[model samples]
Target: MKHILALLFLTAASVMANTAHAENIGCVSTTWRVVNNDKVCVQSFKDPDIEGVACHVSYAQTGGISGALGFAEDPSRFSISCRQAGPIVAKKPIPKKQEEVFTQRMSFLFKGLNVSRLVDTENNSLVYLIVSEKVIEGSPFNSISTVPLMPWGTQAPQFQLK
Candidate 1:
């Protein structure tokens, strides 16, 4: 039973997770008391399975000695905005909705921020969502963005959605 629960937990955590690496854009000091001031920062990453779509996430990063040493738990306050970096190309078929497309650990353990994607076939757009959660608790703080599907080079995506 213990092994089964562990498997379920791991599976839930990584379901459809692309796990893209973040490229730090920059950071600004939000608090002056700490050496490493608590600051809101922006980072960019691209979808591994879907080419040409990139996302920019901004969140509050913990500061001070703990944050400097990577031992602080960041607050659940982040936003996501996905856009067409170049041409919209889905190497894999877009799902109606997936569990998660991106995830970033807020702390060292089971606490982190998660991003999921939804296909809006009616609007012909892709919607991305961000939610902060913990193993024992969850945050209501969340964000969303959408990218409409259109021709990149000369034609739109050739794939059909269900």
Candidate 2:
């Protein structure tokens, strides 16, 4: 029974691991703080479950003794932009409601950056929303970007909604 439980746990983890991951593209200095420098970090990520869409996010990162040590909680200020990178195709069904596509840790604990995706069937677009989350408090700040179904390399995507 223990081995079976472990296998189930591993399977669940592997399935959930399809979440999108970001690559650190660059950072720009924002302010010179004590013991370190505050800056904005730019990250790029591709949709893990969806094809032909890429997103770029820029957010502020606190820099100081605490931040340098990975203890500071990043502010809830970020911008997102997603564009069509290639021919969009989905063999499986996609959700019409918002679904989480990515999550990035901004602190040692209690804070993270998340991106969600929603297929706008009416508008024939894919919407991506980025937000910051805290364990105790909720954030109202978020950014959204959309990629409309359009021509790519002489072929247009036939969006299928389920």
Candidate 3:
């Protein structure tokens, strides 16, 4: 029995360590409790790898072992928001379909929030998309923000496949 307990302890520790590392390298994970004390604000941050384009994402966390094992019956509920907190300059205008800049899991059951950056070529603007998803259904909670590329002399070149 002792051996079994020790092995389980080791396994749990390893899983937790990997989760922490995954959350740190390319993203930031944080937890904030809801005012009602029934849910937590779990957020993940992913900065655009491209220079001059900065993005941040925050989302809510709902269901977890706490609710499953600790007698907390209510699943966690969340809200998400994203913003371009800096000057928007593109080394090159990113493609519309290839615009998913960041993604993070919002729950253990395959729910997630994704942020994508789209180039509105006709309007000469940049559009940011924030969407929430789950395994069975997607949340209607979606938001969009746009930044119009100004009259700067540097024009974005059209993308072409080599």
State each model's CA lDDT, in order.
0.82, 0.84, 0.49
Write one digit per residue (lDDT tens) for candidate 1, span 104-136. Answer: 888866688888888888898888899998979
TM-score of 2: 0.85
The TM-scores, one per candidate, come to 0.85, 0.85, 0.51
Off by over 4 Å in 3: 1-49, 63-93, 151-162
The TM-score that candidate 3 achieves is 0.51
Stronger candidate by TM-score (1 vs 3): 1
Q: List candidate 2 stretches off by more than 4 Å.
A: 1-16
- Candidate 2 lDDT, 70-134, residue by residue in tens: 89988888999999999987656787888888877777755778899998878988999888877
lDDT of 3 by residue, 78-140 (tens): 333434444444445455663666655555434556666666778966677777766568777
**Which has the greatest lDDT?**
2
Which pairs of residues collide in model 2?
A: none
Query: Which 10 consecutive residues of model 3 have the lowest summed lDDT?
Result: 19-28
By lDDT, highest first, what's the ranking?
2, 1, 3
